[model samples]
Target: MQPIALITSPFTDKFSIPRQPGLAPSVISTVSFVGDFDHTASIEGIQQYSHLWLIFEFNQHRSHQWRERVRPPRLGGNKQLGVFATRSPFRPNNLGMSVVKLVDVVVKPQIKLVVSGADLLDQTPIVDIKPYVPYVDAIPEASSAFAGDEPNQLEVCFSATAEAFIDELTSNAAKSEHYQNLRQVIIEVLRQDPRPAYHASKQPERHYVSQLYDLELNWYVTGQCLTITEIRQQKDF
Candidate 1:
């Protein structure tokens, strides 16, 4: 299918993205229509809905071969399950769907949508967009064996230097409003302990780097606490 739009997300790479939408509600994204789909009239009634379903392609994994059996992150990425049973990006079509909150719809300045809780990567192609109808989309009797409940979250903390850096970034009036909630976004993402299951088990004390927006986060885990050692702009690296 042809892409109707493309999304610009805070997640620059796959490592720091939440396993599911709404897991990190502060992460926002912008969907810009493209080609013939860039008409404001096409999204005239979009504001009526509180949420939307974004049908996007897993473009990053399109080249990889699809697997019938895959390990789900929820199962610690150890147990194998059928691909259809899990939301693994490796699929025949490499397609993914996410439900994101509709923060705003800009019509005057072309067609653009401000959405929150998106799990899409930067410049991800969007094939379709649909309104999330709670009446039918949400099923009360839904149940899953592998993912029965939300995963446990770690305690996320920042070092004094990291805190000072964040304060400086938000201190400027030009960047303050845009970055006011950057700290919360980082906390939510880090608290989820976005590490490979094997790394968590084998190298719990190892330092790691994750990219969020244009910032590079240096962090490490000890016991149930994840600490941020430093935060740097990607340009400085």
Candidate 2:
């Protein structure tokens, strides 16, 4: 299906993206509609809703091949489960659904949506948007099985370098609000620990460097504490 809009976020890459929505609540993103859908008529009543369901594409996955069985990171990435049983992206159809807080809906000039708690990668394509109906959507006795438990959160500490970089970023006149959320998002992201499930066993011997927006995050695991060793702006941009 053709995308009605494309979403933009600070998550420039998937390497450090949150596994699901609401995990990093401070991170905000926008959906700017295009083509025929970028009009007030298409979303006349959108602003009334407090939350929306987004049907989006996994545009960054290089392969569209289907995997009948998959290992889930939540299950330590060791046990194989049927593809249908998990939210594996390597499915027959690489479609994803997420519930995001409807921060605002702007209809004038061009259709745009402000949302929070989305797990989509930067520049993700959105096929559909629907208002969330709490009466039907929020079932009281839902059984999530393995996904019922909350993910473990580690202690995150910012070093002097990280603090300095974040302070400077928030002082930017044009992009202060966006970067202001970055610090909280970073803490939430790291608290949940961005390392792959397999990499957890090797954390003591390994170091990681990933990007969020134009900043490079240098971090390592020491005991139960995850330290931000350095934070630098990427020079490529």
Candidate 3:
């Protein structure tokens, strides 16, 4: 199927994205319609809904081979399960779905959607969009098996240098709202502890780097705390 839109998000890399949507609500994204689907009429009345279900493709792994059984990060990447039982990207269809909060629907100049709590990587292709019906979509008694509970959150802290650096970055005039919420966004993302599941036991003291927007995050986890060691702006090539 052809793509209906593409996502513009701060998560340039999959390494640090939250395992699930709404895990980092402060991170915003734009869903810009593309090709033949770039007409405002296609999404009339979409603004009435507070949330949407985005059907997207794992375009980054389009060329990769699919396996019948895969290891899930939630299982510490140790236990293997059938591919259909997990949400691993290495699937035969390479499709993914997420429920995102619809911040706004822009119809002028070009059709676009301002959404939040999206875990999609930058430029992920969207196949379809559907309004979220709370009555039917939410299952109060649903059982999620081993993934029933939310992951534990770590206490995210910033170094004095990291705080000052964030201040300097947001101090400039004409900055966008996303720029102003940089600190909180970083905190929300880090609190999820964006590390490989196995690393918690194997490489607890390792330093890690992740890309968010135009910035490079330098962080480390110790005990139940995660610290931002540095934040650097990536230079344009």
Candidate 4:
């Protein structure tokens, strides 16, 4: 099938979309459809679905060929497993499926969708969209192997400098709400630890940076733990 258009957002790069949505609710992103189309009419019944299944291109891996076996991050980045068993992006089709919360839809010259918990990078091509059905999709008894039982929560403390910057952003009338939610989401996602398990032994004082929306995060690793020390707008990067 021919791709209709590309969809871009500011929430993350190709590497940043979490394995699943709701894992980071503070991250808000917009999907802008490209090219000429009846944006308003195409999304007429979209509001009816609380969630949407986004079939998007794994643009980062598009140029790379697929591998039969892959290492899963949850498996500590070691040992090989059949590619089909893991959600590795290095696939033959270079496609990704993510279920995201459809918060709002605005129709103008082009359809702009406000989505939450999206794992797609900016300018990624959207292949398709499908409504999620609770009856057919919910599987409470399903088991998670490498994912373990429940997610481990981390303690997060921001540096004074980061707090002050956040305060200034929050005080701004135009960006207060967006900045507040963005800060919380970025903190939560980074706190979960994004480092590869094999790289866990690296220097603990090193800092890592990640961009979400307009925020640029400066985080540090301590005792194999991750912490956010600073957050600033991307313009400052």
Candidate 5:
């Protein structure tokens, strides 16, 4: 498929992103068209729909060998499920589909689509965009045996350093508005504990660093509790 656009997401690395679309509505992202795809005519009437279906490539997750069975993080990584049964990125096609809430469509010097609640990695190439028809797309009878429920939550607390860091960022008039909203982003993300399933229940002086927008998140987990040790702009890292 031809590339239509690329996503600018806060999830530069991947681990910090939500497991699926709509899980992190606060983490807004943008879709900018490549070349002629930016023509306003291409997106005519696209904003009429409340949500859109994104066909994007899992470009960075290319795999050398295909595996018949894959470990699902939601299953605690112990049980193996057929690759076709899970949304594992290591596939032959490496394609991903997501439904995201369309916030707005901007057209001026360049055309840009602002959307919320996407799980795509930064710089993910988009193949196509389609409006979601509620009549057919919202299937009430759909069910997933294991993936139906939301992710388990962990208690999140910010360390003194983390709190101070947040204050420092939000205190600046230049970035206060954005940083204020980012506080919850930190809690919600850490509350889900993005650690690998195999690393569960282990706290051996481990610290995880992740990025969101221009901020860098440094955190650690203890039992069911997570503490944000620090959060600073990407430049300081």
Candidate 6:
């Protein structure tokens, strides 16, 4: 039997998408189908699952030929390691995987999905989608080799104006759910400090605006301390 797949993304461009899922929960993305595959029946029972495993192509990095070993940013980009041991985009197949939250599915003119915690760039081609089974797939004892233990605790402070903006956005009934989730997601990602480790010594104050779906986030970093200064609707961007 021949294998078939579809690709789609909710991001408008690569600049807005997170490098990893759960890193930006406020970042919502879409996963649509290709041609004839666009239909509700294709995902008839998907709503029952809260999360899913997305198999997609690393289309942007396809030009790079596969290598036996590659460097991982998580390891500070200094050591070369086996390709399978890392989530490097440079691979023989240029494939990528992400576990994402399933927000909703719309079927009308075509099958369109609204998902959260997506790490794929906008318009990314989805190769496959499978329901995430927490019972069987969640391995608490599994070890994260080389990735090392989770990083140290980081501080996050919000400016008064930024807090006010978040309050307003969350208070709005139409966007409360999106606002709350996005806030938490942004905070979590910032705590990890997405910048390169080598740049840790550079304490320059920098600002970040991250968005997913309806929520827009404005944040900044000063030394080891980070601040989420604002949250609003994407339209505000």
lDDT of 1 by residue, 121-231 (tens): 999999999999999999989998978788889999999999998998888778776664889999888788899889898887799999988899999999899999999
lDDT of 2 by residue, 60-160 (tens): 66476889999988999899999999998887778889999999887768789999988888889999999999999999899997888788888989999
**Residue 5 of model 4, lDDT score:** 52
Tell me how far candidate 4 lies from the true structure as C-alpha RMSD in angstroms. 2.4
Candidate 2 local lDDT, residue 117:
86
By lDDT rank, best first, the candidates go 3, 1, 2, 5, 4, 6
User: Is candidate 5 or 6 superior in lDDT?
Assistant: 5
Scored by lDDT, model 6 comes in at 0.70
Better model by lDDT: candidate 1 vs candidate 4: 1
State the lDDT of candidate 5 residue by residue for 1-237, as single tens digits: 778999988777887777888877777788999897889889888878999999999888665566789998899889999989999887778888999999988898789899988889889999999999999999999999998888888888888988988888878888775554677777766677788887775554589998887788888877788878887776732
As for candidate 5, its clashing pairs are: none
lDDT agreement of model 3 with the native: 0.90
- State each candidate's clash count: 0, 0, 0, 2, 0, 7
Where is model 3 more than 4 Å wrong at Cα? 176-180
Q: What are the per-residue Cα lDDT tens digits for candidate 6 across 136-212?
A: 98988888887656555468787887777767777888867544554565566567666655556564565666654
Model 2 residue 226 CA deviation (Å) reads 1.1
The residue pairs that clash in candidate 3, if any, are none
The sequence of per-residue lDDT tens digits that candidate 3 reaches over residues 170-195 is 88655546574888898888888888
* lDDT of each candidate versus the true structure: 0.90, 0.86, 0.90, 0.73, 0.83, 0.70
CA lDDT for candidate 5? 0.83
What are the runs in model 6 whose C-alpha is more than 4 Å off? 1-19, 160-185, 202-220, 228-237
Model 1 alpha-carbon drift over 4 Å, by segment: none
Error of 1 at 67 (Å): 0.9
TM-score of every model? 0.97, 0.95, 0.97, 0.88, 0.92, 0.73
